[model samples]
Target: MKCEYDKDTESLKIELSEEIDMSTCKTLRNIMDGYIIKYSPKECVLDLEKVNFMDSSGLGLIMGRYNLIKMMNSKMTILNPGDYIKKILGMTELAKDVKII
Candidate 1:
């Protein structure tokens, strides 16, 4: 996972690799949470364009971030998720909680 924050836009973009599972979820969460705390971005964008697979852990990650951003009165968006990822998001009803584009 990669994280980038734009001060001008007050947005934080997180780019995930092809796969996200339990092995990486904890680390990813720590890093993402740290960045959020440090920057306090108004918008959080999860770039899933490169992600082809994700497990339940990935869903948890998204939900966790969604709640975190909401607590700050910020918004979270899932960007360009692949078909598989999109389906999982839909199945988990996470698509309704966050904007997907």
Candidate 2:
């Protein structure tokens, strides 16, 4: 997993690779949480175009960020997830929670 924070726009765009499973969820969460808190971005965009797999933990991370950002009146979006990931989010009903484009 990799994350790039755009300080100028207070935007955080995370480029997830391979699989977002139990193995990498902690690291992914920590990195994203730190950047989110440090930058206090008005919006967050998670780019999952490169991710090929995801599990429940991955969904948790997305929901956690959404709740966190929503509390601060910020926006969060998930961009370009593949069909597999999209199906997971859809099944979990989290697709409605974010802007997936």
Candidate 3:
């Protein structure tokens, strides 16, 4: 995963990889957690544009980030998720908590 913070928008953009599974999600969660704690961005955008495959761990990561943002009184958005990822999010009803765009 790659992270970029925009001070102007107070948004942290996390670009996830093509495949998101247990191992990758773990590392990504850690990095994102730290960034959230440190910067306290008003909004977070998880860029799933490149993610063609995602397992349960990916859902976990999204939920965890949603909780984190909620705790900080912020917002989280899932950006550019592919069809498969979007369907998964829809099935899980995660869009209720985080915007999917």
For every candidate in turn, the CA RMSD to the true structure comes to 1.2, 1.6, 1.2
Candidates sorted on lDDT, descending: 1, 3, 2
- Backbone-clash count (model 3): 0
Give candidate 3's whole-model lDDT: 0.86
lDDT tens digits, residue span 31-69, model 1:
889988899899999999888779889999889988899
Local accuracy of candidate 3 as per-residue lDDT tens digits, 1-101: 78899999999988887588897887788888998898999998889888878988898889988988999999988889888778788877677878888
What TM-score would each prediction reach against the true structure? Answer: 0.92, 0.87, 0.91
lDDT of each: 0.88, 0.82, 0.86
Instruction: Note the residue pairs that clash in candidate 1.
Output: none
Query: Candidate 1: lDDT of 4?
Result: 91
lDDT of 2 by residue, 10-90 (tens): 787877775788888888888788878887888888888888788888889888878888887888899998887788889
lDDT of 2: 0.82
